[model samples]
Target: MPSKSSARLAALTVAAVCSAASTVVIASPAHADAVRIHDIQGSTRISPYAGQQVTDVAGIVTGVRTYGSSRGFWIQDPSADADPATSEGIFVFTGSTPKVAVGDSVTVSGTVSEYVPGGTSSGNQALTEITRPTITVVSSGNAVPAATVIDARSVPNAYAPAGDPAAKGSINGLTLRPTKYALDYYESLEGMNVQVANTRVVGATDPYTELWVTVKPRENASRHGGAVYGSYASQNTGRLQIQSLGKASDFPDANVGDVLTGTTTGPLDYTQFGGYTLVARELGTLEQGGLERETTRKQRRGELAVATYNVENLDPADGTFDEHAAAIVHNLQSPDILSLEEIQDNNGTKNDGTVGADQTMSKLIDAIVAAGGPRYDWRSVDPVDGEDGGQPGGNIRNVFLFNPQRVSFTDRPGGDATTATGVTKVRGKAALTVSPGRIDPTNAAWEDSRKPLVGEFVFRGRTVFVIANHFASKGGDQSLHAQYQPPTRSSETQRHLQATAVNTFVKQILDTQKNADVVTLGDINDFEFSDTVEILEGDGALWSAIKSLPRSERYSYVYQGNSQTLDQILISPSIRRGCDFEYDSVHINAEFHDQISDHDPQVLRFHP
Candidate 1:
């Protein structure tokens, strides 16, 4: 075993190598206030002291990384004769001076602020602020500790249990938390850059393929970004597929020897085969950052037409969207706001290798533009598989497309859609809150996954709080006693919980806006007569615009050849009294006059 001093030296080296690109360095006690590079042979002699001032020290640069908004670099003392091993800090000021790259030995002086999160006893100190901690170059050298190359995505499943999910996979040193289903050791790297080495299994071969690769932080990345450098290993369930870095011509061509580096644009996400995270924006990549795009538009009447449609598993090859294209031009009733469901995210085009949902929405926008409709700004909250029962690379999700001129983008979880969370409900909705005239974005609701898509809409003279819901369906199980089985209350129970949550949320909103006009619409999956609807409406306390008409004529869906009213536009009396809106139960996506969806599309028009 290495001595404590040697271990300290090794740890410092690891930190330096890991953060090779950052500009700031870890601080040492020698020149406390001055931000200088120190080359300590061993790190054990370093004391657990911080917040001190150090000045004037020279050493070798080990690694670099970006800390929060600031860039940080690491340095170490070169003398093996030192009593205790120690490392010094080197801060980079991007505002005034140029950023320091790897292998540059610079002397600096500044305050030492130790990194202590919440409640931990670690004595390690983090280097911050290079402005006061002046740094000057002493020497420069080639980048040290060359990175090992590896392809992790190509590994096949070596230890997958029968009937296990298709996404489950393991690497030589990667292990996901069984119960929590997360990367337990990676909370800090949730929205940051990370690099790791793991075995890549190709065929049924032994030892598989081993390579070191950098993983960009994504919304669905592993918590400590998936552990590396350990006796513990990863198991490939074949869910993680990568090539020998040889198949570059046909694919996007990330070379096996290519170093992976990007920013932590999203959060930690997990899947069944292995942990999967997203890189919303890559520091250096062919793909642009998700936040880089701009939304264009045109504003019309005060009333923004809001439309929610479940495009029904949009496939690139279906070509049925041409009909949808026609609808945007002629058949479709233009709305100021449109929320679509089941939009698919394509990873290099698996569907007939055509355009993706991101581009499809763009095409839809173009179609609307050709029809002289307002240019719509759209956003999709990249959903990581495993959060509230999502699938990785499966790509299907709900999206919000709106008129940028009428309603400006406001506060979102990450400037995108928000997944609703609830204790009782399951299938979630994406919530968006926009203040009239592009007001500042603030957190509008305080619910977790499985909640409703709560939207604060400003229409006419009042800010209407609208909740667009696509509730749980009573399909799947057919057994009569399934509702009472285990903790799950069958499919009926699922719909019931959705109703309850919508009711609870609507009531809360109504409490503040006594005359609040709350309209709940979409494919509710239950009929107007179902008990779920009853609980949602609260014994005639709520009113369905369709209920005001005759009973037989209220059906909007055709079930088993019978016209069942599944799609409904329910509202609070305050909203119903304001304007006369008609429910256009047209066969929009319907085939040859046949209903397109198992449920029909309902529309509501009100004066703004």
Candidate 2:
């Protein structure tokens, strides 16, 4: 499954194919005492019956998950209690695949436990399950409960209730108001059979055969029909993730803006990657929207187009070179300058002390040339073996690809992996001590991350400084659905220091020559509105071009269900003040099912 942060679940599903007739549970004669699923679930986030033993918890099997480590079955009571806040169904955690079938009427005896996905440290909400169960087959071929329809009207507008101030904003103890909050609504139907009709796909299906759809069609809807996560306050409450109980090979290949036609029925379950998800027993039919890749217009005669693309750990071994080249030639229109991130070394992941990327860079350049783009020349300092924190042996680093026909690179000697690049004044103009160099490479901020690659390029006899960066990723951050309100972004601390260092370096260049043109662009691994971007734009010394685009068109990457911004190009005062710049978040890759990279390349065109 995709690892998450507002970023990215476990669990399987069942549908109409698994469910049979409406039935009620009869208390076992052995243990006359029985409990409704709702009574065990209670009205709070944590189950009221937690750690306590429940006898004769009876219901009909609605779904059976026969694969994965957490193999289990879902059972729902047809005769549900009137309380809307409590669930009518529950998951029976069987370590191995249970022999139970969909229509079997079963009575379970086990300890009620709150099982947290991804562990307690993940800050995820716990799932109420019946673990270490002793199950009795009362009868066979009974019908399950009718699925609760989850439509726009049924889900509330509010994302979640505020965590109690005393308990540090945790809503665990708060009573669920299903009609008022979306999280509460999902909580009420946890493990219950549910369905959505004609839902819009917001997140494209990933390798794990999982996708996301929104119950509310218009909630923060983007131009491309995906949900736009504009701010922390607007959580897009209607978004629900979908994963199949069926075979992965049988799942439909879907893209953004596509439709899940008719009804998709599944058991609602809380998961790790995604918060609340529909484990689909029966998936809806795919209705293609035919989303085509977007191609930006070529730059004007006087405009210099500089683009940034994360080739997604590209190596010579991957077959995506042709596709990446085509996107650069046709979709990006062959820019004058290109900043490439995640470019792996030669021999790709074979370790063996091979730090050179000549073969890898050569293949991409050759492919670009074959695709009708210019025969681009590349410049980069190979990282010190495994210091850069990408795939261990991949030695991923940033590289600058410039069209020699359009731009000239000022190649000064003495630049190496660990040597810090310095700025100097040559004849009253800002000049790099080394043309293609690493900026403050040994600094603590870049300890295990890709260092900033600063290079000097002359476009039309004007010196333009372009710094390519691939900052620390958001690996350890908590998800948006974390139990704690306003989940913490722990990964931003390193990016903060890195941003400060880069911002300070930009100031040094500007201090030497106030009118110097600088373009700072790459995979920021953060949102446009994040503290990292703000730090990079300190005191108007630099300004991000991404903010120039409208809110709906601002995103260059999609995580989970949110169309968010991660790649950005920030310009110095000289470039932003002229009002001659145009920025495009080229949507060639991110919104497609068959994408070459997870990030969509961003292009900036301006007169230097």
Candidate 3:
């Protein structure tokens, strides 16, 4: 989440699928213990109970998301009556890995909590995360379907009873309304798969052009986790959800009734509806052949490297990345540590007039691979069903890519790209923790930036930290910086908070690790002379590539005829001794005003 400063600009995306039905009836039960999956639609209500010792559920896996290793998925609720998309629900685990597929029935056991609302936008309510009562699934399979749905009064601690008069207009089954204090919740369930039924499609609308599907729970819906793994709408006006969360461009010409199933790997949210909320995770369709081949591709050298790039809103206006793959790869060489900024995820158009982010990433990947780089493996940060943080994949964010030869990764915790963390930002950065031996030891202070990624790397005999940061632009609150304003809780002055966070973050890192070798690079959005840069440098002996060059030629990015050293490569002297890195200011847009990235390339040429 963008530190609190950028909350205002951060849009609200997901919401509770509520029905304008009757009030929910509250009741105290004999046992307020078992984690149950209940789906209440019209007069039908399905509830399933599970064992008290089970902690994770795995059935016909539905949504599968991966945050490094923390995974999440939806096991089919035997009590389901509607579509599996609506009936199967959510479960998360940092422990063992579960393998299943869509349409395949299974059961999982895990803790359950009620999902809180994130915010409201254009009449749609946003959810936080899937909330559930805890339980573990002992076993699962093509279980018998639910015969009937019990009243809300049948379940213990029913927030809204099945007959409560006040629970009529609920959001995602819960009576709660959307608010700003909501905490977006998500689970990490990668590699697992599942099958479901009773799904009905809701047509495209603002905030969501895909089909909004809802599934009824099975007869034993309450057996394990809650019902409703994920609810996805068709992406194309015709239907782009037939395949996994794979790229729309890579997908075959979508035919009606095509079964699209893939792995879930983003955030999922729950919204209040019928006294209960909806549970969901973002899913990516599994690739047919290329993905398997890429998965087995060898790495370049010894130590793994991670790189970040914006790819400059990578989307062809003429609709083709296949033709430009080679050229694009030449510009964005594969790196061990790949952090991509502004990558798209969904298949719909946003207010910004661009195709879906998912389409963009897919095309970029295909083009990159076709150009003959190490078959790089990639992953995206999915969104919570209820906490739909405005737009798909919780708003345009970065995805990480890695070469197995250099390094191997399991799971990485993902977050919204533009979450406003109170005093920090209006937009957030996607970050992850690395293994201890993966990097150098002197770079441990790299975890300070909320926008920063912390990962363990095994480099040369020791480990270190590597940070990728993109700071606030000269835009947003341009008037405030001119006025030299102080920080405030209001979203209006978020830029100040973003800047302050960077300043304090850098200081705290150095203060804590005096002998560390730190590297903070990316699109700072401001020139070397701006307050943003000075704030980042502080009283320390800060060093950047531009600092070593003549003032007139130090600029790395040129905007509107004005040259500015916005893209930088800053490092602590300790890590500079043996490193052979060069800041290649490609002047990307210098030749074409509309190049992919406004910023130039900053290359770090060190033997892995």
Per-residue lDDT tens digits of candidate 2, residues 450-525? 9999999999999999999999998888788887776879999999999999999999999999999999999998
Candidate 1 structure quality by residue, lDDT tens digits, 1-608: 00122333343343322222322234554544333232211122122323345566554444444432233444443432322112232233332324554567667665543222110112111223333456677767743322212123322223221221332211111232222211222221221222333221111101112111233222111111211111002221212222121222322222221322332122121111112322221122222111111112222465455555655545444455555544543544555556565555554225343223676676667767776666777755444332211222334544566666666543334233333422111123223333211111112321112223555555544555455555654433321111111112245666676677677656655654456666776666666766778888974446666666543345443221123456667777676675455444443321112223333355555653
The segments of candidate 3 whose C-alpha lies over 4 angstroms from its true place after superposition are 1-308, 315-328, 351-362, 379-394, 408-454, 460-462, 476-496, 506-517, 550-553, 577-580, 606-608
Q: What are the models' TM-scores?
A: 0.41, 0.94, 0.38
Q: Per-residue CA lDDT of candidate 3, range 253-313, in tens?
A: 2111122244322213232211122222333342222111011122245533334454443
* Candidate 1 worst ten-residue window by lDDT: 201-210
Candidate no. 1 TM-score: 0.41
RMSD of each: 20.8, 5.0, 21.6
Task: Give each model's whole-structure lDDT.
Answer: 0.39, 0.87, 0.35
Best by TM-score: 2
